[model samples]
Target: MIQLKHVLVLVFLCVFSGISQSTNGYELWMPYSNIEDSSLTKKYRDYSKSIYFPGSTETLMIAKNELHTGLRKMLGLASIPTNSNRLENTMIIGTKENLNSDIQQSLSKAYVEIGNEGFIIKTVSIKSKTVLVVTANTDIGILYGVYRLLNLMQQHKNLHNINAVDTPKIKLRMLNHWDNLDRTVERGYAGFSLWNWQKLPEFIDQRYIDYARANASVGINAVSLTNVNANALILTPMYLEKVEALARVFRPYGIKIYLTARFSAPIEIGNLETADPLDPKVQQWWVHKADEIYKLIPDFGGFLVKANSEGQPGPQNYGRNHVDGANMLAKALLPHKGNVIWRAFVYSEHDADDRAKQAYSEFVPYDGKFMENVLVQTKNGAIDFQPREPFHPMFGAMPKTPLMMEFQITQEYLGFSTHLVFLPKLFEEVLDADTFRKEENSTVAKVIDGSLHNQKLTGMAGVANIGTDLNWTGHPFAQANWYGFGRLAWDPYLSSETIADEWLRMTFSNDESFLEPMTRMLIKSRETVVNYMNPLGLHHIFDTGHHYGPGPWVSELSRPEWNPTYYHKADSQGIGFDRTPSGSNATEQYAKPLQELWNDPQTIPEEYLLWFHHLPWDYKLKNGATLWDGIALKYQQGVDEVAGMITTWSIMKPFVSKEQHEEVTMLLEIQLKEAKWWRDACLLYFQTFSKKDVPDGVSKPLYSLEYYKSLKFPFAPGIRPQWD
Candidate 1:
């Protein structure tokens, strides 16, 4: 057996080796960076000289261990337990049930406000000395409380008068990993899946603990382990054991494990002749499978399904609609209180009609047809995850359907992992979009949490960007998107600017010298990427398959809908696909006021001008510039913003650690090059149809359109195999 000294050396070696490995961004928000704020360090040291956790439960144990580990790494000292006369100036942690009678009575008022999964941090004078008390209603609550206290210390906030009560607004806050069984993440750029399935159940990685800590710190309550485009093999006995191991690790952190269920699992797992949802044997198969999974993992969050979408098999294959399919699985999981999150991202290669209208048309009629445990998961937009898409038409359209908002934390459309695009602003745009259901502010948030529709069982899913990289999301700044997703998932009402400020304070430096410019850079980052990549409602312009770089000229895919040109419909007459009455009449899907507003380009927001209507090259924009000039200027503005981000990050070099500062500096350079690439490639291609000179003050394309079009990336990553 290895001695204690040997164990210490092994741990040191492992941590150092992990850090030295190439900067893939797998570390995420759990950087565990040594705390830098001098005043804050002293405050934490004074209040946490010793900790006495009264509870002796598994959750309380986890809370104590995590607090000890985090403090040692972050504050350079571990908490010592005290027994004799309550140690003054020390941190006290416990559930209400475990606290001493007198202490419990005093903390009762605070506990009432804390609620379940809520906590309170207060500095009280005990026998003429100040002691910080961290109390919660439950052990899991204390775990969250401990993390919250640490976060305050890390951010260098004054712990003198801390009183915060936070309860998640949504019932389910989750990360939906598009990670495959073989560990290849769909649309994932950082690296292979963080889950090493082959080594799991035998060897539990420390990374799993770190992942749990990162999530719990941000109040993310659940994680789906597999891709919605799932593998049936994940449900077999072999994989169940692997999943149980993960569940064991995550359980203490208040995160429940969920799996993606392949819709045709009956046929795939049970050697059944058919997977028709109504079939008795098929129903029995799912019931047994859910039972098997629950037996292995008691607190399992149910399945996330991607049925009848993009050629995935479903009950639709047997002529049954989504409601027919979802209800069947919902019934199977009802006994275990598990849910069925059926995705509404369905489209067809054969639909000559507008893609935006497909989901709304298929599901609106079946609004109240689902099971009580079923939730129809809808993406932010109707089409794929575009850089900028209007809110999906189904938001207020489904009054009876419990529609959960699905946002992508991964930057699949916004330049993958290389570009520094903060997505809170993007989320803010969609969340605040006036669905015009009944009133002016009938927002998407209201529809998602069952508030506007007056239903129950609220949920929200973010397609995860996590991978096996050191920094988590590839780019250091990209971690903000993940952080923002969880915060917004917890409270959808929080503004994008607010989330940016919090993330900047937590991830980077809290000094205003560093915060002001970095916050500005983050707030504008998403729009900068949008301007450079797909301006004026232009969508799906990236190359086919890999989806990297420009491919506006791509019109040779197997299906017309799969081609970039099919979405843009750019021609000599004008650019942009007209979804107006004269075109596909797709705007009819919106409610009265929006349908009217979007029907005319003159009334629409400038940010979404080209999305609704097709305009001539010289059409006058709201900004007093012609459409062509406006488009060119927007692209140039994007390139300039990226340049500004570079300058902003350079200013932060002194505030941030050299290791992190240098990594961001290098990534910004890559972003600048790619921003210009997007600009040149797009302008060169679009200039062909406009038959005009490059707009004044806008630099001419550095290369010929033919040269830009000739750029090929046959070896680009994230390409899904046709056979798979």
Candidate 2:
């Protein structure tokens, strides 16, 4: 009996060990691993000797708990509470009003600069004793400061004599989750939606709390908890209670909940005759609905509307315009200080001219017509989220209107989370592009941040990539995209390199060996995707509907703009859409210098060469290679880069955890395979037009053109669920 019991105990121990060995990546960048360096751990313990935080509110308690949790995990010492009012070397944290008089006087200058949402952390001498103080104008600010302090500790940076005052450049930074009511996430590759609507408002999952914590740490202020393809049922009483419960959970973390407002909700939910913005009954219904939502959740953010686009209902259905649809809702939300985010990603089937010019033509004419509370959210590129495209002309064109930036954090068009593509590089390129609207330094970032036009309300929205996956993002490196989006939304001027370094240190390790190579790989990952999939200003050539892989030959869609053949006007003579003055004149939408620069093929940047001006197959590129040769070489270069990334990660086994290292290694192998697949498929299709041989350095595809085109993906993940 004793021998049998020993054998069973050994088997149980083996199973337990196996479970612990698998790192699920749930902790994200806030792993809070114990500090291995004895010297740094001792220093952190010394700084966090005692806590002087004083507040009974949930937000304050959250701040206190986070500081304690992070400190204990990192330094193995919980902060002792201080009984006396006099300050020593204890860490002090609270709002400016809640802090004691002596602490307030010392931080008055810092407080004057930071606005309501900004925070300040500094070391000060109080009563001849050194104390570190984190003070802000509000409890949310205090919470932000706490996260900042903890992040610094996680990076193993010294906290002594620290003085930092930070404020968000934009007024609102939000994450738009494309999650459906049934827990299905559109374009979400991680797993099912984090929201369990079936069990919500009663059985709140711990995931919701962790979600709030992660967003709070990154300074994301708002979350739209539904798909932009809005449904009317979410507005009904059955769902409002569930949304309210989520709001209650996220409120303490400074995250306000917003919902996508279905344009026909009046007809669907209120049983009205028509959903017209001009109809008095429709207007009254919206006012009552807004009032009802506010009663349940007083701090509700607002509505995100996708109107008259992609067959969604809008004021256009009722012989009205976008301003009419947006203003009607704005008036109802005006009393609650809520704003309406009307998307500018519109294109009509009738407009057979360049689809790229449709949004600017529709919105620019009515620049100043929008209400004060309405913001026009424009995508980074005019044409869908292609791997590469020029900045949207709408950025600087709508000077009188407040245009917010909409960046897709999910890899819908790029590779759907299976391929590791760092999107911040793509975002930074768009933000840093010069618009030349007002002056030389007039960048797209300046336009969206309200500095160029001196606009009051400014905001940035990222379509979130979070889900129920053990790792918040499917790929380990994909989390950096979410982190990068928040950091850029907070400060548009920050470089991608800076963000990558910060994330690498916090998420993986501070070891220079791991940080150096991984940072290089991340910085170049997006461009590698662009090179393989759509080099030289190519746009929207993905497969129809799901957009999983390449389909440059697809042209069967009913609408002209819906087909890949419409965007890439490839023929026997040459390739690319001619958007120049001789063609569609889409360059005229940009400001003066850009219009002149893009009209001529010689003056346009090589990256945007084919986008504006279609040229002959034998045209010479800037690198002295023929256009066909350059295109082929770019495809090969992309595949080579992926191979290099795999090799780079292979040597990083010593620095990363075994589970993380193995997961990334397998993902990188998948990425390399997909990269080759993209290169072979696109080159074969375009080769028919060029009628040229593959370049010297380019590797010839193993499969025939027919073989490449015959590939199908009927069971790809993240496809939009068709509802009856």
lDDT of each: 0.83, 0.88
Model 2 per-residue lDDT at 501: 92
In model 1, pairs of residues that clash are 24-470, 25-469, 25-471, 25-472, 26-469, 26-470, 26-471, 26-472, 27-470, 27-472
Worst 10 residues of 2 by lDDT: 13-22
lDDT tens readout by residue for model 2, 1-724:
5698898886665333322222577887787766778899877776677777888789989988888888877775654555445355467777887677877887788888888889999888777667788889999899999999999988888878999999889888999999988888999989989989888899999999998999899899999999988988989999999999999999999999989999999999999989999999999999999999999999998899999988789999999999999999999999999999999999998777788999999999999999999999999998988888899999989889999999999999989888989899999999999999999989999998999999999999999899999898898888999999999999999999989998988887788888899999999999999888888877788888799788999999888888999888888888888998899999998988998888888889988988887888888988898888888889899999999999999998777767788999999898888888888888899888888889888888888889877888887877875432
Cα lDDT tens digits, model 1, 604-658, are 8877777778889999988788888988898898899888888888777666556
Score candidate 2 by TM-score against the native.
0.96
> What's each prediction's clash count?
10, 0
Q: What lDDT score goes with residue 677 in model 2?
A: 85
- Please report the TM-score between candidate 1 and the true structure: 0.93
